[model samples]
Target chain A: MSVENSDLLKTPLYSLHESLGGKMVPFAGYLMPVQYPLGVMGEHNHTREKAGLFDVSHMGQVVISGENADQWLETLVPGNIIDLKQNRIRYTMFTDDNGGILDDLMITRRENDIFMVVNAGCKAEDIAHMRATMPDHLELTELNDRALVALQGPLAAEVLARFTSGADEMDFMSYGEVEICGAKCFISRCGYTGEDGHEISILAANAEEVCNALLGEPEVEAIGLGARDSLRLEAGLCLYGHDITTKTSPIEGALQWSIGKRRREQGGFPGADKILGQLASGDIARKRVGILPAGRAPAREGTEILDAGDNVIGVITSGGFGPTFGAPIAMGYVDLKYSAAETPIFLQVRKKKLEAKVANMPFVAQNYYRKPK
Target chain B: MTTYYSEDHEWINVESGVGTVGITDYAQNALGDIVFVEVPEVGDELAKGDEVAVVESVKAASEIYSPVTGEITAVNEDLEDNASLVNSSAGGDGWFFKISISDDSELEGLMDADGYKTFTAGLE
Candidate 1:
């Protein structure tokens, strides 16, 4: 989708967002709400304490149905898609021939088909790539008529359960098709935020009605892309374009966990040699590390990182003031020697060298709902 | 005391030889939540239109330019702990710094209250 033109596309909830006083900005060919009148900080805090609803209609949803769907998908990604149980979701990514990331995505296995959700900005290219690579028998169908919404935070399950049966009972990374307000919807027990929440896939025509009903809940507020960025950053989640790119490999991006052990041994996926080599020897030159600036100033993206001797060692990829931490939090790539947590580092912010350290990530603890042992 | 505004949405109130400077209420509202305010040093000398301070919001960082050739006399230290002052009281207690005007004639280039109101309205 070419976005060079002055005009921007709007989602089904565009007018509703405007009426709610959302600050709309151009994002990935769509005019998305960056924040509401409550502001980014308030919206972020509200999502952490209560529930925040987000319109994710721009995200590309596709269904892959065939006898060899799982086997076909494993050829492109390192994740163990073949073993993904029914209704279970696995976070994974597509890769180029050189072990570089194409785009990160979520793959959910269903009873008869596999549901895939890719980033909105990469949807066009992703569809083209799949069409070119997949076998003729596998059908890749884009669910363009559907709109996606996410209800996230600690109170998300409680609010979602009011509309759908058996929603609160689903464990983390689970999905199912159910009825919501008389509309047949696909609801998943997962979200971008580190909280227990649901991502509901509904028809575009019924999106506004369902969104309004969800917002009518006493504990829910409309969150925008602004809070979504901060919330994910605090949870130590990677943003595709910012943290991982075509030049960075998965091992170097601190996403080694996503590569299944079976795939690592089989060596059939794209760029498996280079990826598995890095995992075995641990010889990568640089690794992604979380950095916390000591003072109040936030060292944003592209800020040069320095070692103890003030020599430049790396650069910040994603950095911002974490509202929940009440201090500036950042993440960047550093020399593998200095990637260890608590390693003292400095950031060159303008003329000043700000004191910082390589800190452990998930600056906030993950609160996913897992079944107790 | 006479108040003036710059095209960049900065406001200055001149009293005697001292000029108190802060961003306009419109700027604060547009910036959303203010996370950090980099105040100019008290002894630093600045030229008119020079970038002296910085205001960082949750989404971006913006520079504040000096409205007149001046020497920074004082900065609102309260912002060190409470940067949201720019959001709550932009024109009053949220003042960024006080400067001792080096060239009083430089103030002539700024817009008055009525002119600033019209300028901001044109922007919308």
Candidate 2:
């Protein structure tokens, strides 16, 4: 279906994807490619073996600046924003008044401003909340016309380095501006796939040209949302809506590391008291884990997770067959008792019980490149 | 020969005393790329319109239903590892299984090739 006629919003790369035989679907209010001609499994394995280019332009990119940008942002999030050096990126979370998570985002301190990229689905609400809460002196500029592309996989460095010199010198979580294909853009040495990759944020006008330039390289192929999901899953990353929400706490979701020690002790940000209490006392239930059906069956989202006696413990958030693993794998929450790795669990698929296990995440190892200090 | 189609998009071709089953081309196209197939074991008895097997693609999974009452006499074991055969040839080499017809009289209820085409046309 054409993007203009469809109810879903269109990204700058929508036409490019259609020309390349991408099967479009509605995602986060945008018409995106769910899979290309290479298909989902092929794309999934390809990203693991080689570099995959993804048009993540739908994500919201905003720049916050002012004399008090750092201090103001620190009040809204739990990250150590004041300690972030120039050109450094930090993964952070937005919490509610009760310490419930609102969204997860990546914050980078540019030379003169703080740049943040948030989930596309939550952009509207995030922007509105920030505007209403922040002081008028703090300027929040939404880069709505910009497009972002992610080149992820083990071989991402080699291919990306050809375009931007000294890209290999930057370590994971570092970012810098570089000129590529005759356009200046911000490149961050980070990605959702848990691989040694980069995310390039460029002007929307240059999006198509940049994508085509990358695709012209022999090692790079356009990936779709299908591979994007599995890649993040294999990386053990959480999807915001599924793995995290306003109702879920960081401690309960196993994301204690994102909360700074000072924040936990000082008790600032939303719901800090409730979240800190959970950290000290512990959750009544834990967001545990589960594996795939040992057989050929693929356990999908919303499937019921059961214990030995057919009692419900948790629900599957993201479950599907992993092409690289050659078996089905999933992640979900369970009772604290059954949350341990290798614990046996049963997934009710239709009329039969499918055997599964509580496997550790990153189902595959992450290969991020970090420079030695 | 007569044919029947399931709502799940599988088709059954019945002859004098035997029946052959496979998924429809429309089903294969909607499924994107086929990666795995779970055919029923030989000698398994099936009721009309029973879920006899499963087909998995990169994006989703679907159940394949039997179109007639029969006992499975043969299954295409090759598809277990090479499920792409269904995407390439959904009707011919992609035939999922062969059944020893339990009721030859049931063939009268199925549609012919032309009738099946007309039935599917209504779907789109």
Candidate 3:
């Protein structure tokens, strides 16, 4: 379906994307590129072997500062914030009073302030949640003028090192402020694609320049949201609205690893009573599982999953062809008994019941760079 | 043999009361890198505009409709192992099925080569 261009918002790199042959589509209230001329398959493969740049300027970037910023922030999120050393990033979710996920985000702690990267669709609510909850002395500032772009893949470090100092030396989930193409940029050694990469946040005016410089590199190609979604799917990462929502707590999403021990025990964050209780009992009703279709038909989202006896047990949340795996893969929530790897499940796709099995995720291996302990 | 095109981007090349069906290049281009295709079973009856087959690309799934009323005579087995054939040769080796034409008059409703070209041009 075509939308009138005038009704949608455009990023600062809209002109550059158009010049590069990007197929623009509506995503999260913005006209974003879904794929370039290289197409989704080529872009997914290139990002694994080389580097692909993506315009993620639609995500909301915010900074929370003032006295006890870390302590104050801890009250709203499940991940331990006070203990996170400067320049380290932690994946956390803001939960409601009932332990339901409000939104999932990445919080990067600086020397005195904390920077957050939130999902584009949930940003407005996330920002409002912080503004409404944080202590009176704290300051919540939205960096609306910044454009976020991700340089992802095995060759990402090699491509980024040329433009920014100390990029090659950064560890996974580490953050730093550096200059890229003469623009002051916030660089994070992190990405949604399972490959080793960096996310660069730049000023609106300098987004085109930085992106142009990266695309000039022989190893770097412009990747659109199509590859981004498939890459992250194969990487076993959850998309906020699809895989997790306010109705889904972290434990049910198999994201319990993101919640730290201190928070799990102390119970100060929102919905801590329920989240901590779930942690203690380990009785989650349904859990997310990786699924592989036995046949060639792709079992996409909203397809009902049935058990051995043809009784409906779950539904697919994210489903599609895993371009890298060369097979169709999906993630969905299933009853506790059917969530185990290798458990047989049937996907009711259209009129036929296609055979599928629960399997281990990260259909592609993760390649994040970490410091050897 | 006369080839007719449907608005859904399916082309049926009819010969000797049998029609070979496949998606057009424009359909494949819009779909992008087909990875899976579900072809109708041989001997199944189809009506004009019925959803006869499915072509799944890396990006999304598209339905290939029956351009004319007919009975499925044979299906393409190559698509089971190499769905990319739909992307490489959408109109030739990538054909989805063969149908025994039940109504020659139904073919009159489809567009010829020149007409199909004009029809697609107006979309852009």
Task: Compute the DockQ of candidate 2.
Answer: 0.50
**How well does model 2 score by local distance difference test?**
0.85
Q: How would you encode candidate 3's per-residue C-alpha lDDT over A1-373 as one tens digit per residue?
A: 5768788999989999999999999999899999999999999999999999999999999999999999888889999899998999999999999888988999999877999999999999998888887889999999989999999999999789998766978989999999987899999999999999899999999999989999999999999999999999999999999999888888889999998988877889988888888888988899988999998888998899998789999999999999889899999999988999999999999889999999999899999987666
Error of 1 at A204 (Å): 0.3
| Order of quality (TM-score) | 3, 1, 2
Q: Using TM-score as the measure, name the better of candidate 1 and candidate 3.
A: 3
Q: Which lDDT value does model 2 have at A29?
A: 87
Q: DockQ, in order, for the candidates? A: 0.73, 0.50, 0.85
lDDT of 1 by residue, A27-100 (tens): 98899999999999999999999999998898999999999899999998889999999999999898888989
- RMSD in order of candidates: 1.6, 3.1, 1.1
For model 3, which pairs clash? none
Cα displacement (angstroms), candidate 1, residue B33, comes to 1.1
Error of 1 at A269 (Å): 1.4
For model 2, the superposed segments whose C-alpha errors exceed 4 Å read A1-5, A290-292, B1-8, B35-53, B65-85, B92-94, B97-124
User: Which has the higher DockQ value, candidate number 2 or candidate number 3?
Assistant: 3
DockQ of 3: 0.85
Output the number of the DockQ-best candidate. Answer: 3
The CAPRI-style docking tier of model 3 reads high
lDDT of 3 by residue, B1-124 (tens): 9999999999999999999999999989989989999999998998999999988888788888899888999999999999999899988999999999998999998999999999999998
